[model samples]
Target: MTMKKLERFALIAMAALGAAACASVPTYVSLDPSLPRAQLTFHKGYEGTGLFSSAVQNYALGADEYCDSAKHAALFKNVSGTESALRVTPDVRTVVWAFTTYLNSTIGAGGVLGRYDDCRNAVIFTPARNRNYDIRQASTNGDAQCSLVITDAATGAAVRNVEVRASPDCIPRTKAARGSNR
Candidate 1:
């Protein structure tokens, strides 16, 4: 082979090696078994109890397509506000993981892989009929249970039934600054 051709091949090989080296799957903590499992439903739009809105859902589906060969997982956290309604705070990093996992698996891998990507929506809880407080609060001493449901992005259907239990333990809170005056 010509000198120039050999150098070109070496460059290509280096680039491929670099790209492969940078390709890595992020790690996720195993779901907590002690937390109560909540049921999450994926809807076509923002009309119902689905975690993500239609636009977010579309993006998740796109991610699923783009990362079809990578493993992924999803994470959900709850944020507190003065309002009495139940609120869902979603972590985008977890959504990316879900997409990666779903994409890496073959079709119909079940909800286990797909549901990991459905962290786009926050499930809000409202008081039950004739109740004065949030249903979550009423049901469990103000502690709400969060659940994750995985589904196929292409068909908008469930892929598996791996139940993720949500408990107060999973919620992260901001710590007070040290050495600050009260």
Candidate 2:
């Protein structure tokens, strides 16, 4: 590679790292019982684990990037893991998207690329306080299609008043505008 290309790559990588640092949100830890909360489980299916696929090892819940600058401090994002269940305050909208693809990259000179042949599913919903919700992401049709399911973790019952969607869309939350400079 040329020196110019290397410098450009470094700059892009640094910018991405900086952005990631700025977007960081503390992981959910329900230490206080007094706080209104709900437990959630995140699951991700890896259809293509090799190159060309996204580097997203886990999906996140909550607005890690913040809904608006006005609610900057209110950001909450927890990545998927089996280490433990995550806690979420009721009434907060959550979005999760999983990339499932059968179009994995091949090795060698004859290797080709998959053009928009990937599969994915996204969901958005609000949890009830003190409830246990399970959010599962799945893929089918040779990983060409994706699916999402949110339900009670214990009873296996479908959650009420919640929408399970094939694509994600945040049901915009309202927060009063903060003070502005005079």
Model 2 lDDT per residue over 44-163, tens place? 444443333222323455542222311111111122333235666777776554443232233345544333244445556777777887766555323445566777887899776655
For each candidate in the order shown, give its overall lDDT on alpha carbons: 0.25, 0.48
Predicted candidate 1 versus true structure: per-residue lDDT over 61-180, tens digit per residue? 111212332232221112112222111222211221111111111123342121222222222131122212111111111123222344433455543422222321122222442223
Q: What is the TM-score of each candidate against the true structure?
A: 0.17, 0.52
Q: After superposition, how far is residue 160 of candidate 2 from its true place, in Å?
A: 3.1
- Model 2: lDDT equals 0.48
